[model samples]
Target: MTKKIVVLGVSGSGKSLIGKNIADKLDYPFFDGDDFHCQANVDKMRQGTPLTDEDRKDWLATLNTILTDNPTAVIACSGLKPEYRAMLRKGLDDITMIYLKGTIDTIWQRHQKRDGHYFNGREMLESQFATLVEPEKDEALVIDISQDASAVLNEALSLLSKK
Candidate 1:
């Protein structure tokens, strides 16, 4: 069976960084969910607007198709709501979710330093947290983001190895 991991979190919690590291370590293809968003969605978010569920359906479907196409891959996505995560889980097997859990303050600090991304500011981060339905204990391997990237990546790899 294919092995897939979804690295999920609010923006600036390091989903893309850690997901890329995990993918590189595992020799799996990496997909950034942001890259799948339509121009309209990008425009909205670039203007500091939060996306509605309706705006995300097609994007989620595209991620699902990417998952199906790349049997072994790591996906970086803001799988914020339970419904969004559930949408990604459809028609898949051997999939594991890793939530890069962090406090708003921690994420906000990182957010401030990030460059060249569409997600504009703390308002969007706040919106993401508001919308987030944290992955249940049984649904994901939750990793704290307080540690450095290497430590975080090592911890994730260690946990995933057992599965």
Candidate 2:
């Protein structure tokens, strides 16, 4: 069955690249959770502030609603904490989470190379890691981001096919 797929990770982990590719491959809509963020949230990130759970409540709920409304879709989001993931999954099922895993050093380097993104800074990334609760074996297909983007996408496609 086709399912709602979430490409999840910290900022600069290539979630957008993989998520969009998978969405195209599956002929599903692509939703960047970043795009769903309110201007206030965007401004906070732009200012190098890490958002608290309360800050994410509406954003997470809105993403969940989008998933519910479009059951077959792929979304890129930083599902950082267990509660956040739970929020995304609320009122939905058959959601496949693909976590792009990497160390802060790797992600920090990538973040530096990115242009015009609001989510910024090593400090912010550190806060994200601090809040993160890695998905268990059953909850996600974890793809290490050390490999080339093509390799990561191929692996994700292969894993999704099996699912």
Candidate 3:
């Protein structure tokens, strides 16, 4: 089975970490939406400026294309809003949506540990949370990311088998 998976959450929710694990487990390719951001958007984030919807428009479209273009892969993206998720699913019905859920305090702690990443705007995490619209139960497999990465990966893989 060719699987197209997207692990979504706000910054520092461990989407990328777990996305990579999921891809490895399934022997599928892994992509980080962050890697596809335009230089301008990267600059904005690097300057502690939150990217507006305008800044994200092209990047989101690119990610959408990547998912649609790939045969089988797992992607990690900060799919904060419903519109963003919709764009990602615009014409694809088989995409597996996984939402990494955690609290502000939990994710904040993890976010602070990150090193040499462009998304260094610690204050932006709050903005990401404010913009986030969590997927409903019917739309995605929601995984709690307050635990260790291995535990979270096991939980997601376990739920995925039943999905």
Candidate 4:
């Protein structure tokens, strides 16, 4: 069976970085969900405005289509809410959801260091956390982002191997 992986987390939680690493390791195509966003959504986020659920409908549908098209792909997405995650999982089965778990301070520091990203400021992070419904232990392999990238990637690889 083809493996479908979604590296999900709040903004600046290293979803893109970690997802890319996993995709390279697994030899699967990698996609950043941010890239699927419409120009209007990108503009709003670039202006430091948080997107509402309505603004994300088309973007989520696009990501879902990507998953449907490439069954063996790795995607980085801010699947913060349970509804959002559910939307992504609409048609797929056997998906591995990897949650990059981190504290607000840790992610905030990463956000501060990020350059040229549409997610402009730390102000939106709060809203992200507020909307987040953390994946249950049974539903995801939760990796602590406090660890170095290599260690986290190693752990993910090891855990995924067992599945």
Estimate TM-scores for all models: 0.97, 0.97, 0.96, 0.96
lDDT score, residue 75, model 4? 92
lDDT of 3: 0.89
lDDT of 1 at 26: 89
Off by over 4 Å in 3: none
Q: State which candidate has the highest lDDT.
A: 1
Residue 64 of model 2: what lDDT?
A: 94
Candidate 3: the clashing residue pairs are: none
- Runs of candidate 4 with Cα error greater than 4 angstroms are none
Off by over 4 Å in 2: none
lDDT of 4: 0.89
Better lDDT candidate (1, 4): 1
Candidate 1: deviation at residue 82, Å?
Answer: 1.1
* TM-score of candidate 2 versus the correct structure, residues matched by position: 0.97
- lDDT tens string, model 1, 1-163? 2399999999999999999999998899999999999999999999999999999999999998988888698999999988999899999978999999999999999988988999988899899999999999799899999999999999999999988
In the order shown, the candidates' Cα RMSDs to the true structure are 1.1, 0.9, 1.1, 1.1
